[model samples]
Every structure is written in structure tokens, then in C-alpha cells.
Target: MTDASIPSDGKWIPQAMSVKYLAKAKTALRAVASGEKVDWDTSGEKTVPVEVFDEDGQRVFTAEITMNVKLN
Candidate 1:
């Protein structure tokens, strides 16, 4: 699972996301910012759980992103 942490009032800077999932990540991030349910699908055989933590160390956002290969 890929994870990240963000401080309160901080913005998300895209890392290695490609064009396809980058857009989806932005949308999901927006929904998470608004406290709405995230509707995302990995659409791949493997799942990568992306977690975002608040400055207070609380979990804020979570989504199972897609990955090409499975991790051991």
C-alpha cells in the first residue's frame, strides 16, 4: 500500500501518479477534503491502499489504488 501524510490546510502534491489515476486521485482527494464518500476502483489485479494522514496523526483519506504488480 502506498501511503502519505498531509498537514492541516496543506495541499496534495502529486507524486508518481500517471495521467489516468492522477485525475482520479485529485477527485478522491477533493471528496475526502469535503468529507464525502470516495468512489474509486483499482481496476487492476493488485490493490494499493493509499492513505493520507492529518497533521494530528489521524487518518484522513484512504483509497485502494491500482498497481501493475503485487507486492510481497
Candidate 2:
């Protein structure tokens, strides 16, 4: 049986050169969703409130990145 290849963990790349950027930093429906264009700065920081959920669907983490160095 051939083993399926998993996706990458994510690495920095040029914003224009990039085709997509996954926003898996949140889980709540009211939080960041897929295919959502967020505002970022030169430091590549997007000010968004995130709420993470556990395996049991319980809110676990709430992160507010002071400086998210994700330069597309």
C-alpha cells in the first residue's frame, strides 16, 4: 500500500507569489474562516480574535498575536 503524503506545516513565502494561506489559527464559527482575506501589515500581523477548540469541541486557547511575522 502506498502511504499518502501529508501537507507541509507551512513556511514563509512571497505574498504575491503565494496562491493561498491557510488560517487554521482558530476554530469557532465566529472566528477566522477559510478563504477569508484578512488585513495585515509590513510585519505581516493580522489583528484577529481567535478561539481554539479541543478534541471534544471545547474552547481551549485564545491567541492575540502581538506581531505575527507571516509575510506572504
Candidate 3:
């Protein structure tokens, strides 16, 4: 997560968001051994929780974003 930047027009421009996954298993080891050249399978969608806080450290809003996930 990153802080938003305000432009001259008084609009907040937030940084690009992304998702990352860490794997530690046989499948992961195989993928690594293959130099990550294996086909990926769609696992499913996941909901990521987000929270917005004000300058006073108070929770102002909360939200969730759905993202598609893949597995090797």
C-alpha cells in the first residue's frame, strides 16, 4: 500500500495496486526447477481488505477488492 498524491486539481491520485503470492511446497519447487515455465491454473478469486485512516489516526473507511489468483 502507498500514500495518495494530490494534484493541482485537488484530486487524489493513488499508486497502482498489486497482489503477490509466496509458495513453499513441492509444486513450487517444481515450478522453480522448471525456471517458472510451467502453465498456470486459475485457482479462484480472493477478497482483499483495505482500510483508510485519517490524519488523526482514526479509521475513516473500509473496503474490499476482489482479485483473480492462479496456481502453478
Candidate 4:
């Protein structure tokens, strides 16, 4: 995975990407459902950091993903 950062000028600056496991899926899921207020302006969409690892326990990549939840 390629890592990059954007400045106020709005440009794609590429950087080196690294990975480290912060928590397991269960832990992350619990945190997401921790009863935080939704931001309507974003339509309940949230970005979370995730890490991918290989079967041999090797780190693959890390990235942020957007999750959308629909409420009844």
C-alpha cells in the first residue's frame, strides 16, 4: 500500500506506507458500536484504521476505510 498526505493546497503527496496491528476485529467492532453520536452531515459514515496481515502473521498493509450504517 502507498501512503500519502495532503496539505492545505490539495495535492497528492506520496509517502512510505507501514503497518502495525492495533486491535483485533472484535475489539474494533465494539469500539465502533460504543454509542457515539452520529454526524448527520456525514450520513453516519466513519473512517477507521485497519491492519491487514498474512496467514504467517506478517504485516501486509494498513489503511483507513469508510463505514456507513443505516439506522431504523
Candidate 5:
């Protein structure tokens, strides 16, 4: 991931980016879901909030990204 700044406001935002960036994001997600070790640059945070969206452009759920994320 690049040095993109996450918005401080708690709002769901969509970002426009290159296909390469999308691919990289997907790879990172896949790695995390597939039990691969992920080193998150949280800057000393314990958990990060991640919202998952569905195909209908709706948020299905939110996840807490942490070091002890259950692999699998």
C-alpha cells in the first residue's frame, strides 16, 4: 500500500485508482483472508476498521483488522 491518508471523518468513501492499485489491494485482501502473515502499518494501533461492500453497492459488514485476525 502507498502513503495514502485515510480520512479522519467516519464516512464511507470510494476511491478512484488505477487497475494496478486495485490488483494490489485485492492481493493484500487475499493474503489476509488466506492466512498469510500480514504486516500492517497501523502506526501502533491495535485494530483497524474495514468495511466490506457487496455487489449491490451496500455495506455488508465491518471487520476489525488486528494482528490476531483469525486466519481462515
Candidate 6:
């Protein structure tokens, strides 16, 4: 079972993401990111978890993003 959950806080938020890896992954996923060959774990899909923290060192929010691998 996939136990994926996101927090509901107003503090934590997303600022930016790694466009380089994303663009590379989109262009030639197997050749650029994972390696020359296709890796199962990173072959088709991926899930990215983002954590938001406050100045007091507490978890405020959580965000998850699913990346679809496009092999061309």
C-alpha cells in the first residue's frame, strides 16, 4: 500500500525545483539521469517529497510531486 500524505500547514511552501534534472529526464531519461540503461526504480515514475520547516525547527507543511518519466 502506498501511504502518501501531505501536511496542512500555512507556513511551509515550495520555492523552486530542479529543472535541470527534470528537463534532462524529459529529454533522455535513461541516457541522462539514471544511466545508459533504464533502471526500474527510476525507469518509469518517481515521487518527490518536500518538507517545510519553521525557524523553531518544526515541521509546518509537506508537499509531494510525482514525476513522469518520458523516454525519447
By TM-score, the better pick of 2 and 3 is: 3
Would you estimate the TM-scores of all the predictions? 0.32, 0.31, 0.39, 0.34, 0.31, 0.37
Once model 6 is optimally superposed onto the true structure by TM-score, how far is the C-alpha of residue 22 displaced, in angstroms? 28
For model 4, the stretches where C-alpha displacement exceeds 4 angstroms are 1-43
lDDT of 6 at 1: 9
Residues 1-72, candidate 1, lDDT per residue (tens digit)? Answer: 122222233333223332223222222232232212322222223333455554455555556543343222
Model 3 quality (TM-score): 0.39
Q: Tell me the TM-score of model 5.
A: 0.31
- Count of steric clashes across candidates, in order: 0, 2, 0, 0, 0, 0
Model 2 misplacement above 4 A: 1-37, 41-45, 68-72
Weakest 10 consecutive residues of candidate 5 by summed lDDT: 17-26
Evaluation by TM-score, superior candidate among 1 and 5: 1
lDDT of 5 by residue, 1-72 (tens): 212232232222223321112111222222112212333332332343455444444444445443321211
Better of 1 and 4 by TM-score: 4
TM-score of 4: 0.34
Q: Ten consecutive residues with minimal summed lDDT in candidate 2? A: 1-10
lDDT against the true structure, each candidate: 0.34, 0.35, 0.33, 0.37, 0.31, 0.34
> Candidate 6, residues 1-72: lDDT per residue as tens digits?
012222222122233444222211212112112222323233334445555444544444454544444332
C-alpha-based local distance difference test score of model 1: 0.34
Q: How many pairs of residues in model 6 come into backbone collision?
A: 0
- Over all chains combined, what TM-score does candidate 1 have? 0.32
